[model samples]
Target chain A: MRLIHAATGEGFNPPSAKDFELPPFIEGVDWATKPILLAFLSVIFISVFFIAASRKAAVVPSKLQFAGEGVYNFVREGLGREIIGHDFLKFVPYLFTLFTFILVNNFFGIIPFLQFPTMSRVSFPYVLAAITFFIFHYVGIKKQGIVKYLREIMFMPGVPKPVYILLTPIEIATYFLVRPLTLSLRLFANMFAGHLLLLVFFLGGEHLLNGVLGLKLVSPFAFVIGIGLTFFEFMVQVLQAYIFTLLTALYIAGALADEH
Target chain B: MNKDENALWSIFGYLLSGLLVWGGIGYFVDRWLGYDRVFTLVGLLLGMGSALYLVWLRFGRHSG
Candidate 1:
C-alpha cells in the first residue's frame, strides 16, 4: 500500500497477469515464445545429462552417474515403489520422466536470463495433466476391464440404493473432471504466482529507484526481499514438481487398486 | 504416512466435487424454475452432508 503512496503524480504501476504475456522470440511466428523455447531446451538438457550419465557404466560410479542415479533412485524408490507398490516398476519410467521434466522446467523460473517457468503458461500444465489423465485411465481399464472400472467409479458398494443418485454424480465428477483439473491448476497457479511475486519486488524496486532520495534508499530493501524470495521460490519450485509427480503416481496407484 | 496423505487428498477432492457438482445443478434448476436462490443453498447443504458421509464410508469406517 505504501508503495503507491510514495509516488505522488505518476503512481507506481505494480505487476499483474499482463506481465506474464511474454512477447514472441520470432516476430512473425506467434507460437515461438520464451517459455516454449525454454521447454524444448529443458528436454534437451535432461536427455543429454541422463544419456551421458549412463553411457559409461562402471561398478565404481563417477560423479555424473551418481547424480543421474540419485535422481533416478529418488523417483524409483520414493515416488514409484513407495507410492505405487507391487507392480510399481512398470510405472517408474513415466514417473521418472514426469519428475525430471517438471523439476527442470520449474527451475527455469530462477535460472538467470531464462527466468521463465514454462508451466506458468496454463497450456503447458494442461497438456501434462491430460497425458497423466489418459495414462491413469488407460492403466485402470487395462488392469480391470472397462466395464468393472466404470462400475466401480459410478457406484460405491455398501451404500443405500437411493443414495446412489446423489453420491454417484459426485464420484464421476471427481474422477473425470476435478482430478485432472485440480492437478494442472495446482502446478499452473504455483508457478504463475511465484513468478508474479518475484516480478513485483524486482520491478517495484526498479521503479522506486527513479523516485525521491527517501524512496531510493528503500529500493535496496525491496531488492533484498526479492533476492530472499527467489530462494523461497526455489523450494516451492522443487516441491511443486515433486507433488505433481507424486499425485500422478497416486492417481495411477488408485486406478490399479482392485477395490476402488 | 503415504496412505494417510492419499486419503486426505481424496477426501478433499470428494468434498470439492460434491459442492461444485450439486450446487451447480441447483443453480441451474433455480434459474430454470425462476426462483430466487432457494435451491442453491439446499443443494450446498445436501452436498456437504453427503460428502461427509462419503468420507466416513471411505476413510473413517476403517479406523475403528
Candidate 2:
C-alpha cells in the first residue's frame, strides 16, 4: 500500500489552477502574456477575415462570402430577431460583433500552438459583462425614463405594501450584483474548467509513459480520452459563446419592455 | 426564444441574491443579538423560499 501510494502520489503531478498563471513574455512587462497575445491575434484574425470576405461585394457570394453571411444571418435571425423584436436590426451589429469575437477567442483553446481561451482569464469576461451591464441599463433608462425604471425595478405592482420591504432589497441585489456576476462567471468557469480538464489528461498521459510497466500499458487510454475530449471541448466552447450572446439579447429585450 | 433563456439566468440571479442579502442580514442580526445559529438558518430558509416564489411568479406563470 505504501509503495503504491508513493508511486501514485509522486508520479501524478495533476494539473491545478496554478498552471493557468502564465508569466509575462517579456521580463519587465506585466501585460504581455500568452492569453493576452492570443487575444490580440484573435482580433487581427477576425478583422482580416471579415474585411477580405466583404471586399469583393459580389451579387452571388462565393464560398468565403457564404461563410461570413451564414454567421451573420444566424445571429440576426436566431438571436436578434427573436429576442429584440422590432428593434432587432438596431442591435444586430453589436450582437454580430459580440458573437464572432467571443467565438473566435474561445476557438483559440483548441487551436494548434495557441491553445489558450482568452475568456478563461476572467478579466475578459468581466469586461464583456460590464459593457452589457451598461448597455442594458442605458436602454432601460432611455426607454422607460430613469424614475419609472427605478420604480418598476424596486416595486412590483401586485405585491403588498408590507412585503415590499422584503422583496425590494432582493430585487435590487439581483439586478445590480447577481446578474453581472453570473453572466461573467458562467463563461469564465466553463472555459477555465474545460482547459484544466484537457491539461490533466494530456499531462497525465505523458507522465504515465515514464512510469512502470502497468502505467505504460495504460497511457494510451489516457491519450485516447484526451483526444476525444478535445472535440467535446470544441462543442462546449461554441455553446458558451452562443449562450453569452443570447443572454445579452434577452437582457436588452427585458430592458426595453414596458413592464419590469 | 427570449423568455426561456432569460428565465434560466434570472432564476439563478434571484436565488443568489436572496441568499446573499438575507443571509448577510441574518448573520449580522445574530452577531448583534448573540443567538446560537438560529437566525442564520431561518434567514437562509426564508431567502430560498422567497427566491423560489419570485422565480415562479416571473417564469412559471408566463410559461415561456
Candidate 3:
C-alpha cells in the first residue's frame, strides 16, 4: 500500500472490505442491518411493481404493462422454452420470480439513498444458491429414481471402467459443490467488487477535494469517471442477475434432461 | 446467450470445483500422512484431468 500525503492533512483512507460491514441501524439487534432492510424493501418493491403492472391489463396494454410483459416474455421464451424443453411452463413461475427478485434487489445498489447491494452481503447469495441447489437435486431425484440419478451422475458413458475411479469424484464435486458455490460467488463477487469500485472513485474524489489546491482541481475527473462507472455497474448488475437465473434454469433443465 | 456459453460456464464451474474439492482432500491427506507435497500435487493433477475429461464428455461429445 502506497502512502501519499496530500500536503493538506492526513493521508486518505482508501475504502477497504471493512466498508461493507455497515453498522446496524437499530441498537442491540443482530438482524437489523441495512442489507436486511434493503432486501425487504426489494421484495415490497417487486410485489407492488408486478401487481400494479398487471392489475389494469386490457386489450391495448399500457407502457408499464408492456414493460412487465417484455421481461416475462424474455424469460419465458429465451430461458424457459429454450432450456427446460417441453416442461418449460411448469418452471416459468419459478424462473420469473427468481429473475425479477434478483434484478430488483440488484438495482438497489444504484437507487438513491439505497446504495447497498444486498447480495454483496454473501449469505443472501448463499441462500439463493442453496435454494436452486435443493430444488434442482430434488427435481432430479423425483424425475429419475434416486439410484439411477446417482448412477448417471457418478458414471458417464464412453469412459473406461477404470477411469470411473478418477471421474466420479470430480463429477460429484462439480454437481454437489462447484455449481452452487460458483453460482453464489459469481453474484456476490460482482456486487462486492462493483460496490467497492464505486466506493473507490467516489471516496477518492472526496479525498482529493480536501487535498492541496493543485490536487483538488483533478478531483472532478475522478467524479466524472465515477459517474461513468455507475452506468457500467448497472450493466453488470443486470448481467449478474440474468446469469444467476439462467444458471438456475439450466440446472433444472439438466435435472430434467434424460442423458448427457 | 447460446449453448456454447452455457457449456463454457459449466466447464469453468466443473474445473474450479474439481480443483477445490480434490485439492482440499489431498491437503487433508497430506496433513494426515505428513508428506511434503506429493499428495497435493497428485490431487490437483487428478482433479484437472478428470474435470477436462468431464467437460469433454458433457460438452464435446454432446455437441458433435
Using TM-score as the measure, the top candidate is 1
Off by over 4 Å in 2: A1-9, B34-36, B60-64
Model 2: CAPRI class: medium
Better of 1 and 2 by TM-score: 1
Candidate 1: count of backbone clashes, pairs at least 3 residues apart or interchain: 0
- Which candidate's DockQ is highest? 1
Error at A250, model 1, angstroms? 0.7
TM-score of each: 0.95, 0.94, 0.94
lDDT of 1 by residue, B1-64 (tens): 6888788889999999999988998899999999898999889988888888889888888763
For candidate 2, write residues A146-254 as lDDT tens digits.
9999998887776668877778889999988888888899999999999999998999899999988999999999999999999999999999999999989998999
Q: What's the CA error at residue A177 for candidate 1, in Å? A: 0.4
Candidate 2 chain A, run of 10 with poorest lDDT? A1-10
The window of 10 residues in a row where model 3 chain A has the poorest summed lDDT is A1-10
Report, for every candidate in turn, its global Cα lDDT versus the true structure.
0.93, 0.88, 0.89
Docking class of 3: medium
Scored against the native two-chain complex, candidate 2 gets a DockQ of 0.80
